[model samples]
Target: MQQESYSQDANISPNNYQLSTPTKEKKQNKTNQSTTIQSPNNNDFYSPKNVNPWKTPKSLLKSNQKQTTPDHSQQASPYGDRYIPLNVSRNLFNKQIQPFEIEEENAYEELLSENVLEIDENKHSSILNFNKQKPEKLQTNKQLENPKRKIDTLPIKVLDAPGLDDDFYQDILHWGKNNLIAIGLQRSVYLYSVDTSKVFQLTQRFNNQVNQIQYTSLQWNANGQILAMGSYDGQLKLWDYNKNAYTGTMNMSSKRISTISWANSNIFAYGSKDKTIHICDIRVPTYSVFQLHGHTQEVCGVTFDGNELQLASGGNDNRVFIWQLRGGNTYADSQYVSWEIKSHKAAIRALAWNPNSSGILATGGGNQDKTIKIHSSLTNTEINSVNCDSQVCKLRFSKIINELVSTHGYEKNQICLWQYPTMKKIHQLEGHSERVLYLSASPDESTILTGSGDETLKFWKIFPSQISNNMSSLLTMCEIR
Candidate 1:
């Protein structure tokens, strides 16, 4: 696996194979009994770079860029004594592509939510919304507070295989306090510790095709960290990451569990491909606590509001459902609670809500055009939209300054920042030549981290407040000149 650092185009779609030349090629046609030669603009699909034969790294990189368990075949911890068997996925797309690897195509092929409103529960539905505060402009002395790259933290290896397509497409990374995890094709889950800079595997085999992963840990019930994996197999598995052991696994449906989110720690909600959201109680250790069935299509993403309470789900049914954690004692006193909401145009892929804004929800558009749309979950309404580099693959809200972190589809690799109402481009976090897969914002909102097909995770600190001193000094120096 060769290691390379490349910049990403923030906004680009998966199907749109961007070659060196235009894809609009003219063709000879007889439309009205007249022969005409079409132009050459339709050549975007067959990227000339595909034929460059330079996809490999300049240097023949060795696979041992990062240290790992020597076997390479497979591994398990001491818990190996007990192995709970679950249904293995047999999908062609999932079985063929191995993890930590990639096989780029010829580069010719381009690939390509919600509800609301009104009175009667049966008739028409309405949404609630509100605009947000305008952000300040970019001050001087940007170098120190805002360094362009964090080379010290970026991964140096490249994982190659078929589904991985490009390394940049695999950049979206997730981390829990001490570890960073990359969610990839098949059941491929790679874990990296920020503390040690070492990487390892979480699951040898995926429940089916690994789509997304959400980490949850609540001190009230279990001290162990639980990972809710939404798989193409239409099942969800909860594994204790700290123990490196599988705790519980269930087949939610035959389709994928599009998204999973932790309500707190013991309580988590999962949206499914079958257009349903199931809220499970980790404490119960027996059955699902509650379920919301309103969306008619596949449920895409799920998130829990801050303050440790509400549940929000987005789906292909074009609807977003909101559920609150009521304190009243239920029949079983379980972690189940209940709520509802508005609709979307196409299927909803990823969603994020502002913890500081009292339910200000930012929904990123999926499907064809990746537009970032914002709405107030409290008062449902279309507030505004942010134009991304390409079709968006994922979007998240920063916990501190209320900023947003968004990752577009494979073709677009750069992560850009936008200040509030003014909608200004604050900074361009560059570096990641392949498709970005997973991304995460630190709890304090000062750092942004990402993982990609390049087989590594990188971290960047948001130079806003703490680094204000250096920026302030630069502004003064410019005035004297």
Candidate 2:
């Protein structure tokens, strides 16, 4: 229950992730994949049962052992009951947040366990929804503040923070804030902490959310820890965190920082409402990377090439401009290296880089233009664009599968999957009731987590086996490329 605090950066943990035992995919013979043990039946008087099976399943056993393995543990002690003793599941998550909550002392009671979320795997046509049981409400912090603030499940699983007031909310997103001991949010970034089951110490925030709040760009570093937030108010802030403390601060721009990204290392870049893109060093903000002109309107999103040598900027003007770092780490040599085919008809809302492919990119927009397009960073051509029902709210690339996942803002609130180069709709991830403002996936590509304005943060499992159009076709067509 103790909350830990840190005053500096060296002490930051990776946040909430821990490595599991290494697993190798080397191919093995089917026989090598498994083995069955047989037990003699007691009625037959010749069979001796192997009471415990290690990693072997009952279904896979030979018919001989089936008769002898069960019906005899009735009078046995607890250990004799085929019990799988529990071990703390510490290595289970790559990154997680302590459930954000609003405390109300004895006024609040626990929500029932029967309430569980159900998921439907298809995007464009499946119907899956949250079980609608309301939980006992909290009496403080939130306006749902009165004891009636109702929650329908375990209090630990509360989705949205209490909407009662600004202070009632947990504006913080700690990597390991709640339970695990050593982790949580340092700034706005997620980090690894020891145990999330316990409360985590939170760093004092950078001035709470201000009115006139609007941002054109927000980015997570490749590690997914640090976040650069640029606002329309012409102010840029960098939030550095772990479960411990705020590390440092840098002043980015005065032209209402339009777009921002961690180009590489401590190197950073920002496109502004000022109609120019500014490249600067994180360690030294005064050192300018030089500003370049291209967009006639506000630059909405910016992404850096894998080499950090190029920057891609997109805006409401319906264009994408690729800028190159003239020499070394400095952008003082910045120039419009290339441009993509006129991609969006409306303001671009999101742009993301593919970590595995240096020459690939994706961009999203804000309207019926809900289309997301993929571009060859190398050829600077439109490989293809996806058609969506609404504005593309958020975009993510899986480093593991090398596929793309995007959330269509108000359009569907559904998650859609796209294969790498083909840009074809693979499967639709349908869930979440509101606009998803933030979405993240594990570096290993296991799960997808999204934060929605519906006032709840929902975590989703992206099954590797989801039916893909191409995968389903192979069985019927028997065509191999």
Residues forming the 10-long window of minimal summed lDDT in candidate 2: 163-172
Task: Compose the digit string of candidate 1's lDDT tens values, residues 1-481.
Answer: 0011111553544323222211345332233122211112332112222222223322324443532222413323223336555545435536677576546743333221122222353655446434476667766797655455332233333333323323211222455544444444444555655557666776555466445443221111122276666566666666776677878877657765656667666887777667777778877866487666667887767787776667667766656666566664344422332334443455556677775578677776554545677776566566787667465556777654546777655457777666654556666666776655456754445666665566555667653434256655866888865
lDDT of 2 by residue, 10-34 (tens): 4433221111221356443343332
RMSD of 1: 42.7
lDDT of 2 at 417: 73
lDDT of each: 0.54, 0.54
List runs of model 1 lying over 4 Å from the truth.
Answer: 1-173, 180-186, 205-224, 325-344, 410-413, 430-437, 453-456, 463-481
TM-score of each: 0.54, 0.52
